[model samples]
Target chain A: MASLKNIVGGELKGYTELLQDARQEALNRMIDQAKQLGANAVVNVRFSTSSVAQGAAELYVYGTAVRLG
Target chain B: MFDSISIVIFGVLFIVGYLAGTINEKRHYKSIKKREEKLLSLPAISMKRLESSDGITKSELVSESVVVSIDYFKRALAILKVLIGGSVGPYESLIDRARREAVLRMKESAPGAAIIINVRVETSTIGNAANSKGAVGSVEALAYGTAVWK
Candidate 1:
């Protein structure tokens, strides 16, 4: 079975294309992690972020962590 | 005789100090309340225009508004007035009111339209200690979201 994948821009982008670059990078990381799991697809994915450090930004990518049928 | 004299003096001094402290607290409470009220009355808005997904035809306007930025300084001092607890701290209530008011405004502003996802709440502070301690502090709240009508 083949896996499905999806990604949406993070809120920090705020109508600007520049920050989208960072979001894309985060998404790429998620895609690579999924591929490493030998999964054909990612589904029900979601994104969240927080200021892990006083002046730093942390982006999180979470999904079902599923296996394809 | 000497012991009684010392006791009387100590009692008088303690009473005076207590009275002074109470007066200061009252003044502080008044100032804080005025600041909170000013912030609550301020108007804030978030606006969005929805057109055809392909960027054609007219646009629809949606707005959300509320009093915003109520922090340690802007929240009512009534709670502190009790020297412990009171019926104040409307931070959550303020947010709820703003959301409701904005939805109502949107309903009136644009009828027969479904607002899109991505509703946003933004807060900003105004009059951040503009002058003296007696000055009133203010804040503004805005709501942002998309509107889609077919």
Candidate 2:
């Protein structure tokens, strides 16, 4: 989340399951990204999202990936 | 005859929905108000550094999240917003509710922690369409931080 947005807008989905699946998928992808970057740990993890169309939403996750000795 | 019956059914649903949605929104707002009064006393901040180092012992990651659906009235209001291409008022409140709910949840996650630092909030939209005509406008908010004790 860059800034706390006061506006409330959401996606209209056909199946509720798809919505959750998207979130989970985003999380997995981010973690994998961190791992691939040779990060041993991720700190201060956060997520933000927005929709590109009527039925689709984009979930974004970010954090400080670090290596611990 | 069928048309009349369908009209009556929809009319009843509209009335019930209106009452339920308004009541729920008002109640949630009240709850947010009460919780905020307490959370404000704590030193919640965006920085990773702690304000005080006295008796500091615990550090852990804590998080809280909530999902809220847009009521029919809000959806209708948002539709009008879409037409005008301006700020969406109903969504503002929904997002507010989600954020505050996440904050309260963070407090509960670690009631004993003195302060939460490096806090962040993330939001997403998740609405389930009940029908072709009905728009399910739902949003989810997630807040997370490193909790510390002194």
Candidate 3:
């Protein structure tokens, strides 16, 4: 499986599954962006988050955009 | 009189150097964190959870271990244009070098494998906190790669 990291970091509360859901949400957005850009894979992925802002805040996701088979 | 003047000058230079080094260290730390944050926010090309053993996995069956190390310095540069302070170079290199060594070991152990999926790189602090400036932080890089015969 190819790995990736989102470009932002923030406080995530609740359980692991919830965090995973949020991560998936961000991943889906990233995949959509990649698909639009005609890229198949992303590598050297990293993740980051900002300090906790609010109960609901923004999550930034990014990765090394790549084309894969 | 001349000796006194030289001592004063040396002291001033020392203080200046220390201050400059501290400022640079802070900048480097911020930059590293920023880059990490940016990398983490993006959607992943793919995500999977692997087991030491169990149900079959997705993608192809390529048993390989790939170790990747990210220098907080390089990461800092990528995130922010900050030249890390002096002492950090060696530690960062150490972490990277260790990762490289581990990767090579993986290669040696697992031959005939093009890549190592479910790759995980672990990092730990090497020295005492007093010795390392705040720039010294431990990191572990994990990734899954496909080992295709090339």
For candidate 3, give the lDDT.
Answer: 0.39
> What tens digits encode model 1's per-residue C-alpha lDDT throughout B93-149?
434443444444434455445444344544433233311232222223334344455
lDDT of 1 by residue, A1-69 (tens): 000000010111121132235545776898889899988676545545443543234545566556778
> Per-residue lDDT for B56-116 in model 3, tens only?
3333322112222233233333333235444455345435443444344433444454335
Q: Candidate 1 at residue B111, lDDT?
A: 49
Top lDDT model = 2
Residue A20, candidate 2: Cα error in Å is 9.1
Candidates 2 and 3 compared by lDDT, better number = 2
Score each candidate by Cα lDDT: 0.41, 0.68, 0.39
DockQ scores for all predicted structures: 0.02, 0.13, 0.02
lDDT of 1 at B25: 36
Worst 10 residues of 2 chain B by lDDT: B127-136
How many Å off is the CA of B94 in candidate 2? 1.5
Clashes of each: 4, 2, 38
lDDT of 2 by residue, B16-43 (tens): 5567667777888888898889777665
